[model samples]
Target: MFDFTPNPTFGPLQNPDLKVPTAAMDAQPETIIVGAVIDAISEQRLPAGAKLGEQALSVLFNCNRANVRRALAALEAKHVVELRPNRGAFVAAPSADEAREIFQARRAIERTIARQAVKRIDADGIARLKASIAAENLARSRRDKPAELRSSQNFHMLLAELAGNRVLQRFLAELTMRSTLILGMYAREGHSCAHCDDHTGIVDALIARDEALVLDLTDRHLRRLEAELDFERPVAVTVSLKDQIFGS
Candidate 1:
């Protein structure tokens, strides 16, 4: 289950609703734990390389260490969390090469998605894209990084959905989650990775049903975002695991 809340300063932020009923948590503790960790990672609250201790997580999620271990194993299988021998689990940190590869994969996949989206997007689809852009703009104006990043990801995922390709949508979902970690580590400070104008232009071309133009814009926008990352200067921001997951 998920819940979204509107922020007074920006627009609505779609953070995971962590307040699960005890019954549900007891039934699916691993699912709840995995979701909370992913949400935190996507939002940059759980920075790359942040330690996810079993004891702390078990306490925070009101579960046992076994459930936390299973959840960590699930996250590791998804490639979003890394488990080390005797060291426990930490958020996955992509190297410079891995980061470039992820973006390259995104460009290839998203261009195809944009082409299909142009062919299939209707009035409702365009409205959704525009709404996402508006929310992104509000987040940028307020410097709400997490919300802005979430909005950007949602826009791309929406395009994938409109493309009507389940396989590509699933692939893009994984790539986007991986990109969040890359961005958290390498994106330059004070830079908007997904510029609002670029998204608007893509939407414009989609409205015109210009497949070639959409493809060009999508490629260029992704390249620009990739260029904004400083591979040589990885930023190491740490957050208290419990605090970031729950609250300060």
Candidate 2:
């Protein structure tokens, strides 16, 4: 059964009958709440299929139920959360096929970005990529999985930004978030290559303005990541309801 316990911040109003606060009625709430929810999911602090209790969220953010509803509606539009008839909002749980499709789409998008980025890449952009690579190396040395993962992900995002296509960048951001969630659900521990040299190869190709080489390296990198995924079974796990509500 799905757990729907309220967080401690909303403890006082655990009762559905309790009235929501009126203070948040006058201001904007959608952006803040949506960001919080997304951050929670991305960090794996909130597990897949966990219920997003509107009342608890309202209290946690010090907003009214109306604003909380608006935030959830926004998440629904992003496909980050789904609304069930009797179950309310829950984090999206992607199937194995869907996960494979997301990676395929990501590879296409990123490969295109890498090709274009080679022509438009500047010294500053190259420096940023170098910094990201350095950060990833540091994280690997320290054995910090989260940091290593984020740094590797940011490298692709930096490439997209360098391509100077805002629309592609936006879409890539959403796709990357979904990919991260899929990885969290299906990845094996210690499976990621934290000290990946593939990124450096892409950067080198970009510096040489070799679009073909850049695309080839990007495609190979993504394929390597996909090969690491354990798809034989779903690895989804239930997180503590208390930790979900009141994060450390």
Candidate 3:
């Protein structure tokens, strides 16, 4: 179980009035469901270990229980959600060791990505980075933690995209989702360590084509986020699975 406040960023999935296009729904109901769950997790509106009931998800997504089952199985494969033998699905709650390892792996992957991104980033890439950072700043200014978190995650994902390596981009996406779980479980502040200047500094380094500085800032930024978590005393909040997804 988990508790969640409304997050505007989940508009498409949460809005009952918004209908899915028939062709897209027919083509990928399971994939759409999978993306919704992952987005909830990544936004931290869905906490670690929150039960993902098939019936509830089916109702929310306007799909069948079988589709929900398939979606949960797909999430299980990504390691962001777990399916117990009899207990059904819950978000995966990584241990402190796993949390550490996740960051370590992120650092390695992102360092390579940062190097590549700095080398290849063009004017358009720089503009996109600024737009993302501006969105993040606006969310933070409004105290919209969920939107802020999503924007913060997107900033990193953008870097992965700019890096031009599909494999590393995919890996970073998964790692970022896992990091959300880690933050939900262990963060003392109940949000990310995404200070405004942290991203700005990284972008500046990218603009200047200073690879070494970018790497150092990126590593330190991640390490600072990791340090903010209180692993020994994991904290969790409870809410209805439906509320967590559709926002109450």
**Cα lDDT of all candidates, in order?**
0.81, 0.76, 0.81
Residue pairs in collision within model 2? none
TM-score of each: 0.84, 0.81, 0.85
Cα lDDT tens digits for candidate 1, 6-73: 22211111233543521255568898888777767776776787778787677666789999999999
Q: What's the ranking of the predictions by lDDT, best on top?
A: 3, 1, 2
The TM-score between candidate 3 and the true structure equals 0.85
Q: Worst ten-residue run, lDDT, model 1? A: 4-13
Show how many residue pairs clash in every candidate, following the order shown: 0, 0, 4
Give the Cα error of residue 186 in candidate 3, in Å. Answer: 0.6
Tell me the TM-score of model 2. 0.81
- Estimate, for each residue in 1-248, the C-alpha lDDT of model 3 and write its tens digit: 54444433333346442234222545567977877777777777667767777766776777888988998989999997888998888889888899999999999999999999999999999999999999988998898877888898889999999999999999999999899888877888565455568899999999999999999999998888888889877454334556569753
Instruction: Please give the distance, in angstroms, between residue 217's alpha carbon in candidate 2 and its true position after superposition.
Output: 1.0
lDDT of 2 at 134: 95
How do all the candidates rank in terms of TM-score, highest first?
3, 1, 2
